[model samples]
Target: MLAGSAIVFGGVFGFVAFKNHMIKQFFATMPKPVVAVTIAKAGLTEWRAVVPAVGTLQAVNGVDISGAMSGLVKSIAFESGQDVRKGHVLVQLDTDVEMGDLRSAQAELALARTSYDRSATLLRSNTVSVAALEKAEAELKVRQAKVAGLQAQIAKKTIAAPFDGRLGVRKVDLGQYVQPGQMVANLQDLSLMLCDFSVSQKDLGLLGIGQAVRMTTDAWPGVVFEGTVAAIEPLVDAKTGMVSVQARFPNADGNLRPGMFARIEIERPSGAPVVTVPASAVAYNLHGDAVFVVREDAGPDGKTVSKAERAVVQLGERKDGMVVIRSGISPGDVVVTSGQVKLEHGSLVSVAASDPLKTAAAGAVR
Candidate 1:
């Protein structure tokens, strides 16, 4: 009875061991699961480094047109939003009183000149004293000065444009009384636009006059306006440690306006071709930056299969959703741009139909 019991137990244990071995063999024979990923070939791109900053748009010439003297508005020669030339008469103040004073002064000056002439002739003939001739000359000079002053006063009543520009909304009506230095309207020369921005003092060495700058404003979507660095402030702000920069963009279409907020990119000169991949391909970590390079290898069945291999890369400038690979990668290398999270060293991978890098470079809808 004991021998029969032992034989039965050995048979049961052997059967369990055989079942486990068969299960392990089945899994080992099955093909490894491949992680589906999107890939792009590393390509050469002209990498131009850029310093980014936000700025406010302004005109090359801008000012607030103001009244110089207190008077009633006689006439408004310019309409709001009018494009005007330099010296264009914009507002005319009531000058009736000034004109009247000028006429009286002119009449008095005429009489004084005649008296002076008569005095000079009499003195030459010994009919008048030299002091009388000198007194007549002095009165004539005073009258002349008074007339010139009245003319200047009348001229001040006529307000004209100081430069060629577009006028903002008129602040006063025809019959409104305006005081000295009161704002009448805003005048801005829009032929050329200026963008004022600030950059950190540490980046001051990267900026220079004539460096290409690209700008965009929310008012104009997808439109990139190009300009050049116009000027850089010599002194850096002590409190903020930033340097002010101005860029000049030609506005022949009059599209750019003052006070528009803009995003600015000061582009450096193009350098030699560098290897680049889509920004998504880079895995940033505290240890280092890295990218997954896809390589081909033979499977157990001798079929070629693609696998992901992680490569440590030194990064450079990044722009337009693409990042420069300064080292550890070269052009024409296949890189996994997406689905890298599921991959490990030597993990089998299959390329997906859609490539993000190509879509980004062409700006196409994905």
Candidate 2:
């Protein structure tokens, strides 16, 4: 019985070994998994960098109109938010009182002139004392001064536009009493607009007068306005450690208004072109950014199996959706953009083509 049991065990062991050998042979005969690859080509590349900042838009010329003389508003010539030209009458104060005063002054001046004429005649005839003639002359001069003062006051009662601009909400209506120095309305020349913003001191050297800037505002959606740097503040803000900048844009249509918030992008120069790959392809490490490049080589079966070689790159300014590479790779070299999380130096790899270029273009438009 013991001998029969040993024979059965031997037979069973041999069968198991045969099945394992067959399975290995089948796997070896099967083909390797197929992977897609994107061919790399050399092309012209543009390098640009942009700095973003929040800013406020303002009219290049803005002013607050004020009442210069206290009186009742007889009429408001301009409607709220009306556009007016320079020298156009904007407000008329009740000038009846001023006219009456002017008339009285004119009457006194006429009487003084007649007295002065008579005094001069008397002095020429030597029929009156010199002191009497001098007294008449003094009274006539005083009346003339009063007449001039009254004329000046009458002119002030009629308020005119100081410049060509659009008016804000009216602060006073017809027949309303306005005190001297009271705000009547606001006026802004919207033909040109300015954007005021600030940037970090570290970037001060990159910014200068006449640099191009692209701007967008919440008030006007999806419209990109172009401007140029108008000025840079002479001094940096000590507390915030930022330098203020002003950019100007043409607003001939009066679309941009004062106090509108905007997003500003300032462009700066980028140095010579270097080898670059998709940002996603780069793996971060304590050392630096690294990418896996596919290397083509012949396998045991005389077919090509893609292999990966680790490459270290020095990165520079990033613009649009592309990063600038300073070194490590060259143009026309294929680098892995995805599926490289577990890859190591000199590891075997399979190339997979994805729509990464399309994705990057879409991001740039946004």
Candidate 3:
């Protein structure tokens, strides 16, 4: 009786296993769910290649205007923020003491000349000693030197512009006592602006003088300023490992100012064929930076179906919401721009009629 009962249980278990196998086979033959995704072809798209760097706008020539002589300010020769030429007087200090010294030196010089004439006449007649004539001649020289020294001192009291530029707000007022080398105002030659930034050592070789640079600033929204590379630092910073670069831009209207923050993009010449895709095509995760490429192949039933496959890419610079694909993907491969979250290695996908990647990237920063 025990053997017969064991046989019955074994048959029941086998029947159940066969039914489960048939059910799994039926589902395996069924079509997979299609995921709607936006796709873009990774192709040879020509874009203005650039190396991005952050920098500050500066004047080609700028300095803080200062006085050279210590004295009470007598007058101001220029208005604040006024344009001036080279040698234009910006400030004038009291020169009364210097002028008085100059007059005294002149009178003393005349006295010495007269004494020298009388002593020389006496010497010819042997009435005065030779030492007396030499003394008078030495006195004349001392007086002449004093006069010249006073004149130079008086000239320095009048501060003049070193170059053509606009003066900043006056830092000294009339009757205010200012010491030597004290700043009186600030001046800048804003006709041409210089933008200075740093670039990495790896990218330093790609830059050169006269390459076009485009810039924009938050201070002036929707406005673009252009320039050319003026200089590159010969040595890289040992600690930071960056090289300095300078660019110049014409500022005829004086729109650009020194110390303003600016974003810079230095143009790069075309070289090898590069593949690019929309920025949305890339997915960042723990595995690595990658993109999902669409593979169209025959399904089990001989029908065309798109499968999402992951491809690791080495990324280059980002420009205008487009990412440069350095490696791991071909030019003609189709990449999913959106709806990549639901994708797996073999996820069945369908291409959306309209590509939404461009719309999603309208205001995105590259």
Candidate 4:
């Protein structure tokens, strides 16, 4: 048994030795890679850092017009899908009974007023008692309140647009009875639109009320709408880790509508200085972000040659095809921006006069 164990150990050791020697020989015989690449120099950039988010378009003043009083509809004063001004009557309920009540109350109020006047004069002349004058005055007030109450009831039967807006399709027909709180139609004030969007809670510090924003919609491709931030929701969404923001834009041309899908960009003020490179410079994989930095070396002919040195980089926000580098590179370093597919650590690179190193845009990153 001991001899068999020794044999197994020796076999394993020989195999390991052979594998190591072969690996060393393969590396020694490996050919160095040569590649052509575009290069860019890292530089200080200070610009607004923008975060991306998707949002929904909404109406600033929108509601479902509903009935507050139940009654048979006398008439629809406005047409469906029409523009209406504030106080424009939209729906009217039958108020013949209330009108009659109002007339009766007015007549009763007149009679009550006459009685109070007589009683008051009589009391002053010491003919009627003070209590009689008081009773007549109380009756007059009751009559007046009855008139007011009846008028209010009549007014409630007439539903008017509360603000200037475009009306939706009429839901209640003329002479159709509707119950209290039953929707008559939808009214949306479309002169101005409200857009509600959300951003990460971490980005909340970069936003504030009244900041300007540029918005785009799939409905109108290539068209941009501008607005200012109207509100920021006080709480972050627990499920999304994002905070909701609202912006308002003028719709004078009537191009924008509610419920449209929108994309928004909010350019904040200048932030701290940073370094950035073209998006093509970044090599992203499951490992992490990296770039190829061009370095100078002495070739076999004792001449300077450019080599690509693979560098792992820490990155920040990306914008407009540029990425902010947090670390692992310095200003004036030549970084391979494109054509890095055949590149590896210590690979030779060719940079022509036409492919001179590009300096990062000034104020292009923040």
TM-score of each: 0.82, 0.73, 0.79, 0.75
lDDT of 4 by residue, 184-221 (tens): 98999888999888999988988888988999898889
TM-score of model number 3: 0.79
Better of 2 and 3 by TM-score: 3
> Which regions of candidate 3 deviate over 4 angstroms?
1-32, 47-49, 117-130, 209-212, 221-224, 297-303, 356-366
lDDT of 3 by residue, 1-366 (tens): 899988999899989999999999989977678899988777766556778899998898999988778999999889989999999988889999899989999999899989999999999999999999999899988988988899999999999999999999989999999998899999999999999999899888789889888899998888889899999989889999999999999999999999999999877777765678888899987788999999988888798888999998888878778888889898777889889999988899988853655534322222
Q: 359, model 1: CA deviation in Å?
A: 8.4
- Candidate 4: lDDT of 63? 91
Best by TM-score: 1
| Consecutive 10-residue window with the lowest summed lDDT within model 1 | 357-366
Top candidate on lDDT is: 1
lDDT by residue (13-132, candidate 2, tens digit) is: 999999999999999897654344442322225556788899999998898998789999998888899999998898989989879988998999999999988988988889888998
Q: Give the CA lDDT, 0 to 100, for residue 360 in model 1.
A: 46
Which tens-of-lDDT digit does each residue in 1-366 have in candidate 1? 899999999999999999999999999987778999988778887677888999999999999999778899999998999999999998999999999999999999999999999999999899999999999999999999999998888898989999999999989998999999999999999999999999999889888889889999999999999999999999999999999999999999999999999999987667887888888888887999898999989888898999899999999878878888889887878888889888887899988765854644623221
- How does each model score on lDDT? 0.89, 0.80, 0.87, 0.86
Task: Show where candidate 4 strays beyond 4 Å.
Answer: 1-44, 51-57, 124-127, 196-209, 231-246, 260-266, 295-306, 332-334, 337-339, 348-366
- Provide the lDDT at 149 for model 3: 95
Higher-ranked by lDDT: 1 or 2:
1
